[model samples]
Target: KANNTLKEIAEILMASRSVLLFTHINMDGDTLGSSVALCIALRKLGKQAHILIEDDVAAFLRFLDKGYCTYDNHIIENPDICLCIDCGDVDRFRERKEKFFEGKQKGCIDHHVTTEPFADFNFIDPTASATGEIIYELLKELPVEVDKDIASAIFAAITTDTGNFQYSNTTKRTHLIAAELWDYGVDYNEISVELYQNNRLEKLLLQTKILEQITVFAGGEAAICGVTQEMLEETEGRMEETEGMVETLRDISGIELAIFVKEVSREKCKVSMRSKKYINVAEISQKLNGGGHARAAGCTVMKSYEDTKQEMMRLAEEYLKG
Candidate 1:
């Protein structure tokens, strides 16, 4: 089933002259890496390709966007195709870029289990460890070569999404692909240092604040942590700096479910959930109008911090009981 879709997508890429690729908002390594890698590969195939992102690239990921990324309000004048990568839906695109889909041929390449087909050509595989894996397979079907830049982007994408091949999503194919990417001279050591070891003082201070407020429940089986706007201001931190905070909760010896809630606005809180075993965070996120992998998922609640935390805790308790 997916092979046919990939073939069709390949045909689209082969036929298009210009392509505009989009990543989801609050971009993560997987989405940014996959989009940028695809952009580079498409350009190598002699297509005019550009990557558009709604938010500023996270400091750690700026290396991937040296000259390939564009953040301006200007739109490409009548691009031949618009490819939304790693995004579950068109609504994930920024308001400015939403119109780019209206009169153009649209396609999507994603690896989310709950994603609906929103494009003319939709290729989704929930089993793939990362969207980058899907992009790699598609690149194989095309006539492009995986250069160093492309390999690095894909390596970062798959590595981060699979938690450096430690997450449950990692499979034989994931490792095989990683081996291929390494063979392309992806600078694995540098990438790991930059991604996992290079932490700013502000981020450490923010982590301290989050740790100070960490709560344990369900007899140490569940943990919850949070950060507010004040916490961000106090630590001189931006929201993007909170990327790996939830993992800290999951790493606790007795924790099976971890929740990290951040106050994005006065009346809104973004909740990130992680489960080490048994519990399915995706189902919990779905109940909150969001979706993701079973082990890692998120949702946004339009409520006060306390209210949102209470709601998520309630859901977590219910799911943990199952």
Candidate 2:
């Protein structure tokens, strides 16, 4: 996989004149930060680079480049190449997929285990903690210089995804890469607080409301919560604020699995799932047209809240049984 990805990266970089980069919808720090890091790397190489994110970035990450969160497709017309960061599959690109692939060259760099290697050049390592780790490796391979800004971008990506080197996915390589980044002047404390701390007033209020309804099942073996559209609208919190709140439910005492469902629109619900052991939530995510890792995964369910919640519960029950 490394050899194939390296050859593809070299070919794609050599062939393209301008490059367009993108990541998944409702992107996290890993997705947003990695995309920007790659864009900066390309620009440093004297290539025309742009990042096309799918939706509004989380408030916490607005500090990077206040204007870097969104892009227009008119600007994406007939590019020389398109690179995807932290996105696993084509479908995750949504409407942008057509315009993205319309470029002369296409590539994807991701860290999801379930990804099917769908790109002209693909570098996907499930063993890696985050796509940021892959970008760091790419920097080493291409001899790109890492400045403070680039280091912060890559550092935010890795630390956020690995839960500050605390999650089970945290590996020796993750720590070593982080050590190298620290050498580039990344402030671990500030970035951690910025990424995981500093919740907005409305976001904290939203979490408090959700916590009221959080429920545990089977003697604290499973945890679940639901957030309705009305609730979000009332709290002045967008879908982005729901990112880490799901884990609060997952981390309950003795809980092996956790599920958080939020109304995306009238007919769609975003489902975030996390597990401690012996559960593959990514498999569950794939069933609903989304994916992540064994411990953390997400999917959008298309149905009424009642029906969607029922379906998600059924799947979680089956996973527990298995």
Candidate 3:
């Protein structure tokens, strides 16, 4: 549960002279866009802000300020406040946990159901479509100017996480906020081009192979695909290249649920889930010690791909049958 209100969190952020933002391990558009937008706004308020992101950021998101993405060592000095944006679990920012705790005022701004308000101040609103939506409101409280740069970042955050406004999580408020971003001159076309249209040939090849290996289950209501390190090596594709692979399965005519299993290591796998209608993939992810929205969710399992896939399929079968 969150203990602090948005205005309260904004007051703390406004009072702070320096801030450090943490993004999740696998830097996605929501986390990156929210953090970058907040950082940019904070700088406009004459505060020192930096976003500590994993070096493995996807190429598509590089349009955001790369200068802000840095480590504690890279910065001239540590910040007074540390905040994690859109990250539901502390483990997501484990690499920077120490530096995060070192801040005088620790905070979290997110829109995830499982976030527990671990920081000194927190604003976790599962009702919000994305953390970017929360950040957009936070900016109004801080009363910082929203420029084109900030607009685009937040736009990407909301757009990507909401699956370009196609996911069940998107609401009237989401569209209203998006329209406001357009008023602020956010380049929606550019964001779309970078996020969806821009693709590497190797990634396409890798996705083709994964699609060919799809396993259907739940009487064609569900499908699953496994991506191994060998497959990446074989296709000369990076792990990040498989970003939308799960959606491909869900898009099939008869499929209501889709799963993408990425073998992170020999004994560990990262899974993404998407649902068309009835299935609540978030509940499914929670069963695997993960959390997300009703239709889209993800988890990392510390088991072999075969074991993990088997368990996920069993769970999928159970949920579908119920």
The regions of model 3 sitting more than 4 angstroms off are 73-78
Clashing pairs in 2: none
**lDDT tens digits by residue: candidate 3, 177-275:** 999999899889988998889888999999888889999988888999979999999999999999988998999998999999999999999999999
1-322 per-residue lDDT for model 1 (tens digits): 2323787899989999989888888788899899989998988888888887768888888877868788753556778888888877676675745555652788878988878776777898889999999999999989988899899999999999998999999999999998999878889998888788877998988888889989999888999989999999989988888898898899999899999999989899989999997888889999989888899998889999998999988988887777
Expressed as tens digits, the lDDT of each residue in 1-322 for candidate 2 is: 3325665575567556788888888778898888788778777887778888767777888766534445687675788888878986777788798887787777788889888777777888889899999888887666468887888999999988987788889999999999999899999888878877788888888888888987677556888888888888889876677777777887776888899998877898888899987678899888888889999998888887767888888887776777
How many pairs of residues in model 3 come into backbone collision?
A: 0
Error of 2 at 272 (Å): 0.6
- By TM-score, how accurate is candidate 2? 0.94
| Candidate 1 Cα errors over 4 Å, as ranges | 1-4
Candidate 3 residue pairs in clash (backbone atoms < 3 Å): none
